[model samples]
Target chain A: MPTIVVDVMPKPEILDPQGKAIAGALPRLGFTGFASVRQGRRFELTVDGEVTEDVLAQARKAAEELLSNPVIEDVVNVAVLTESAQNESQSA
Target chain B: MTAQNTELPLIGDYSTAGPVLTGARIGVVTFPGTLDDRDAARAVRLAGGEAVPLWHAEPDGAAALSSLDAVIIPGGFSYGDYLRAGAIARFAPLMDAIIAAAGGTAGNDAGLGGSAAGLPVLGICNGFQILTESHLLPGSMIKNESLKFLCQDQVLRVENNATAWTREFSAGEEITVPLKNQDGQYVADEKTLDRLEGEGLVTFRYVGGNPNGSRRDIAGITNAAGNVVGLMPHPEHAVEPGFGPDSAAGMRLGTDGLGIFTSVVASIAGGAQ
Candidate 1:
């Protein structure tokens, strides 16, 4: 089985209050490395069969139409998960 | 004038001596998490129209909409506000039918009738979210600037009274209705906002104060053809006296929201005539 990952983020022009709240909390917790933060969503779609160009295309379509709204958010990344990367994620 | 001397008309008052005009059949859609369909139906009935129940997952979308004089997408947390406020419900089969009938694109093809006005559709609250998600209306609803789920009686000034759902209101008339939602902030690009303002498509503007940080204090808007209207407030909740918000008339006596329901019924009846 394979997996397709879709990453969506709020548009730069849009206000991200949730992200800002998280960023504020991080500084209070003594982790002062990051200046700002923006929250986003990630979706992992499991494929039953082998990943192909057609599957990737379908994932991209879903990302644009369902996973993210073009008005306030941008579909930043849509890609297939490699076997090694999947293993690494599972182990971690 | 004293309360007793005032001649304010009671809400949902219809003369029994004359024949009731229940000819217009309006459909109220119920998505999985819809909470206001019953209220919407009651508003339609009070407005002298028959209310038809519509399911979001209706297999035969065309059949569900065929006999309806108008359709209302009421407010609710459809699909439990998953992904986004209305992202999932926007793809429902019934919404596809509504999109087609509203002269909006559904799935890739141009709208059914090629931008010509079709059915009259009103989206309230969550329904407004779905309309934007479906591209029937422009812009998107994000979390409120306050980052809280607000519930209150809101004041709105009608800017465009020619829309199907606002025919009973005069331009610049102020109305009071309930507004409750988490994702109610409306946003759009500057060009789109300018065009809406320029074309007089802005149907309602927040009057007293901005409730949710909506762009330009716009509380409602209508499509170019004026057949499709979307608003953040819940008019259905204020259609009946004693159940509505307080106003100068008396406590819980405000029926300003009834005008929206009656407007559509009158529009449909007038068209038939």
Candidate 2:
């Protein structure tokens, strides 16, 4: 099984209004989740390609090349999760 | 304000709406800080259609919608730039007119996916960023290149002039216009960029230099159906003659940004196709 995950952030040069609003609202919401909260999109997808290092590299490339904007933000990390780990997390 | 504000402009030119122009009625919305609505309106007028003014704060202004064929969200910092350039303005009453012009459908309903001529929505500069938040246009607009606000003329080669707003210009034609913004960078994923480029959706590409560091140096982009267009440059500022920036012709000339307004007017005159 193949797993795909991505996080998208507004480029550093670009200000994040949504993030600011969330950060400002955290105190009222009563969730001290962290010192600061940067908002972004997290997408979990399953691909059809066989799990390989090259495939992973290409996948990461695809993310940076088209999935995210290089000027304003950078991709934090790319990971491939196995079925058992996925199921363990899903079940629990 | 609604189109009934007779003090404002009417729909389409009173004269022959021009065979090529096609009598398309496009509403040019104006906010308090709207810096480019005048030019957008002129472009609509030059393109042989009536240019209507839609107010920024209108809970329900059906008159503006009922009298127009399409809408243009001109650029500017609405609400005095307190929250953000477009952050607070996104929830404005006038945008409802725009949302309605774009069919305001959650999905492809309201005839966007169907054969309906696809209500053309052009968002320039701050307007582009709003389109993203509004979920009308794809992608997002970020800060400028040098991290400092910039104001200068930029040249961009029309990559997909086939868009609903850019049909007057050729795909390869080079057009120079003003680009001034702090958070003007455009960011989207590589896959999305590839799809945009692969599918001929990349409308305009910055040439000479990437002033704002837009991803792929994309100056402008369009939605899947080519109806929605969003860009950073101020095309409205370039519409007037003897005004605008210095032209390549060596005089204080400017290319008529009228093509943007005209393209849609022509389409509408042809009966919304």
Candidate 3:
């Protein structure tokens, strides 16, 4: 199974008060490495069958039309994450 | 003051058309978790119009929608605000019917006739959000700037009187209505905002200032034909006195929102005549 991940984030010019609050509180908790933090929504969809280009195109359409609203947020990324790649990243 | 002419010439009897004027039947849709359908119905009735109930659960609502002169999508936390305030409600079956019936042009299955350009649809609060999600209207609503639920009597100015739901109001007239919601800040791209202003599609604007940080202080807007309207304030909540917001003169005389309902009814009646 291939995992289709869609990351939706507010436009760069828009305000992200929730993300700002989180970043402001992080330094107080002694986590000071990050310069900035912007929060966004992530959806991990597990699609059955082989991950083909057609499946990716369908996923992109869903992300563009339904999963993401162009008024305020931008669909930052829509990519397929396979199990082998997940395992490799986890092991490294 | 001089004596007034008690017998002003009454050209043609006003009562002659009494039998011909049937109350314009306005449909109010109710989705799961919707809170203001009853209020919207009452407002329609009080405005001398008939209120028809349309439910989202019933898939056959579109068939009956043809008889309606106009439709209203009231406010509430539909689908318990899941996946954002109105994202889920936008997919409701009745919403499909509304989108089809809107803009005076019948979609493939709308079954309605004639140009309903004068008055077609009005979406309030959560309904406004749903309209945006459905692409029936533009812009999107995010959380309040303060990240708090807002519940107050908001003042709005009539920015455009050409819209179906604002025909009864004068341009620049101020009206006070109840506005309560968690996610109400309206946002859109710069070009859209500019287009809205340039086209005079902005129906209502905040009188004092931006209440929920809506872009350009816009509280409500109409479509290109001025038939479909979407707004963040609860006009249905301020239709009656004593139970509504207080007036600026320290009185419980807040019926400013009634104009929206009456405006639709009047336009429908005028079109019929």
Candidate 4:
């Protein structure tokens, strides 16, 4: 099976309140040196067969039309992991 | 009279009487978590229009939206507001039909105009968010500036009296309505905001204080044809005077929001004349 992944994040100019709150708590929790924190969503899809270029394009379209909102967020990435690559990563 | 069937004159007539208006079928859409569909439907009835219930789960868009003179996407946490406030619900089959009816296509540049050009559609709260997501309207809503869910009786000034939803109010008239939400801060690119202003599309603006730090203090807006409108406050809740937000007089006498429902009915009725 091929693994497809999509990452959706708020536009850089838009405020991320939840991320900001988490960043604010980090200092009190003895964490340091992090410049900032931003939060986003990730969706994973496992195709039953080999993911072709068509599948990749369709995934991008799906992300744009459904998974993410263009007004406030960007679908930053849509990548397919081949079965061999997945197996390699798993083994390594 | 049986108590449940007893007619209580709590809702006052907000429209100017012309020819007797009747049987205008207004559809109110209900998503899984919709909290205000019943109130929206009741408001339609109070305005002398028939209320048709449209379900989000219903897949047949043609049959679901075939007879509506107007449609109201009432407020609620649809799809539990996953991803973004109105993100997931925007793809509901009914919304697809709404977008198609509103003259938008599946392609870019589709939302500018559509076949539903003259049809009246009003979106309140989450519905407003969905309209933006569907690109039926411009702009987007984000988390409130205070970083908390704010609920209150908000006063708004009617800024545009031309839209179907605000036809009953005069320019600069003030109305009190219940507003409640977390992700209610409306924002858009500066150009879109300016265009909305230049075109007189802003139908309502916050009065007294900006509740959620919305850009330009916008509470509501209409599309170019004045048929589609979206607003943050809950107009349906304020239709019945006894159970509505308090008026400027500090009494629970505000039925100002009823005008939004009655205005659309009157607009349709007037057009049919």
Give the top-scoring candidate (TM-score). Answer: 1
* Pairs with backbone N, CA or C atoms under 3 Å apart (clashes), candidate 4: B103-B114, B103-B115
Each model's DockQ score: 0.71, 0.05, 0.49, 0.53
The alpha-carbon deviation from the true structure for residue A79 of candidate 2, after best TM-score superposition, in angstroms, is 29
* Pairs in steric clash, model 1: none
Q: What digit string (tens of lDDT, one per residue) describes model 4 on residues B1-273?
A: 333223322222223323334868788888877788878888888788877778776667756766778889989899899877888888787787777765556422434334534568899999999899988899999889778899999999999999888889999999989999999999887898999999999989999999898999999998998888999999999987688888765577788889998998998888831
Off by over 4 Å in 2: A1-92, B1-22, B61-63, B103-116
| DockQ of candidate 4, scored on C-alphas against the true complex (2 decimals) | 0.53
Q: Would you give me the overall lDDT of model 3?
A: 0.81
* Rank ordering of all candidates by lDDT, starting from the highest: 1, 4, 3, 2
What DockQ does predicted model 2 obtain? 0.05
Error of 2 at B193 (Å): 1.7
Better candidate by TM-score, 2 or 4:
4
What ranges in model 3 sit over 4 Å off? A84-92, B1-22, B104-119, B249-251
Give the poorly placed runs of model 1, Cα more than 4 Å off. Answer: B1-20, B107-117
- Top candidate when judged by DockQ against the true structure: 1
lDDT of 3 by residue, B177-236 (tens): 998988899888899999999999889998877778888998999899878899999999
lDDT of each: 0.87, 0.71, 0.81, 0.83
Candidate 3 to truth, TM: 0.86
